[model samples]
Target: MWQNLDYVSERRADTVMVLSGDHIYKMDYRPLLAYHQEKEADVTIAVMNVPVEETHRFGILTVNRQGRVVEFTEKPKERDKGTLANMGIYAFRAGVLHECLPRYAQQYSDLDFGHHVIPTMIAEGYRLYAYRFDGYWVDVGTIQAYWETSMALLDPDSPLQLYDRAWVVHTRSYERPPAKLGPQARVARSMICNGCIVRGRVERSVLGPGVYVSPGAVVRESVVMNDTWVGPGAVLDRVIVDKQVVVGAGVQLGCGNDVGVPNTTYGDHLRTGITVVGKAAHIPPNIRIGRNVVVHPHVDEEDFVSYGDEVPSGETI
Candidate 1:
């Protein structure tokens, strides 16, 4: 039910936050919000120390010897081994937002909070507190990240659970029946959302609502969003398709692929192999989307688009 609403921060809240939409983890904001209130800080950010190898793409923070904020960099070119990274989940005081964002928009019109606002606050001597987060966290910003994060849900040792009676991971709903498998359907260790018809073999995948996998289709290690149709004998591996995309019969996506590269046309990831397909985009049937591909919205037929394809709006591909 909460899924229908956009993940953007609400207008009426005293604090506005920017959360990652593709993450599979669940967290209660009360503790972090309460801490921010207690500190009476201008901004409180939730941070976690990612591995040194993965810090290149994240907004890294630096604290002085006493843990007071000293510097913040948005995706620094170099990494310090033990530095903390901002999770993009920011809690900002409404007054700070009103005072800063308007002036912010005048300067860096295209900048987001992570890229501009947070760093600006640190420069202005705002009381920026860092709240260390130790619970389960996943960043599903790319195809590989999506695949890995979704697969993590199936692991017994995974800290994230969808079936938790107390805290449910709610998403947009179609209010349809549970996923139905045909007599010959073969499914294993996958997440099948509501309103899906599984008549094929799906292994280690995340299937969103209204996903229709035709008979003989095999999907493995992939993420398929809502209203997607996989025609008969189609196969998907390590690929991510946006909403309403259709795979023509016998289509092969992400097959014979490496973990961090997408074959479909899309932008390059800060870290490679995270293929991103923007919302409401389309992928033609029989077309092979390669690894690490970044596909923009509104792609039409026509373009050499094997990988990293961009479809401009108001124009056919």
Candidate 2:
């Protein structure tokens, strides 16, 4: 990403704004840029307050009364109470950014804004300012974070309001019709997107576009993405099913204890704290997947059935 930024810097002019797509939030950046110009800061980092216990998952900052950043820590081992965390959003004076990024890249191969760029600039006496944002923001970088944020969207009083006409989140238009619900379907506190067909029970779940929950199936506390097929009598709880997945009849996922241990066979992203069926996977009938298990992308019935009818907790397929 830094390498690509190097090329961008070459063509850019006065100021540059950087943002990470992994976050779930609503923000009008015009104000942020105005604040950056007002402060005349070399770099302005958008920050927000998170619970102290959750600070270990983020890049934390200590800001002075004037909003100037005094200290910066990336994913600190020890929590610092009342500290603001970096939102991975920044507005930089283009010259300052060009100066820092190339020099850092030349000096070290590791090139990330949080891990190297920001801290190094602070140490070099660059005037870094923190733009406080007291709005909803969640870093959906991990599976647990993604699941929780998705569930939060269902809350009537959630901080992240999607229905606010003033700040509409526009997306590509899907021509499909509204979600269809069967006569026996039971849905509660869930968000079923367009083109979905629910014939079973969905509680506290979020279903993406074109998802089909067959009759007699039960999905609770789960997030099922686009075009997935949940077969008849299947059960899904506390799980995340990715796009184009096929859950066969009577299959069960996330039915065991939540305890999990690390498995090095799969990548860190697949080692979610909850069960995750990756995109385009196929699970056979009557199969049981325990909590914290991961069925990798495009995995067929043969690969999945090799683990037998029941997958032990924490095991990845």
What TM-scores do the predictions have?
0.72, 0.90
Query: lDDT, candidate 2, residue 155?
Result: 97
Question: Candidate 1: lDDT of 278?
Answer: 55
lDDT by residue (tens digit), candidate 2, 1-317: 45676677677668888998778899999899999999999999999988888888889988888998878999898875356889999999888866788799887797888989888999999999999899888778777788989999889897898889999989996788899999989999999999999999999999999999999999999999999999999999989999999999999988865545544455465455578899999999999888778888999999975677888767777
Q: Which tens-of-lDDT digit does each residue in 1-317 have in candidate 1?
A: 02212332354667766577756557898898998889887888888888887778788888766445677887777776356888878787876777777677778858577778778888889888888888888776654566677788767666886678899766566588888999979999888888999999999888889999999999887788888888888877766778887676876665433544323333344235444555566565666554455556655544436433322211122
Give the winner by lDDT: 2
Error in Å for residue 180 of model 1? 1.9
Candidate 2: residue 11 Cα off by (Å): 5.1
Q: Give candidate 1's TM-score.
A: 0.72
Candidate 2's TM-score: 0.90
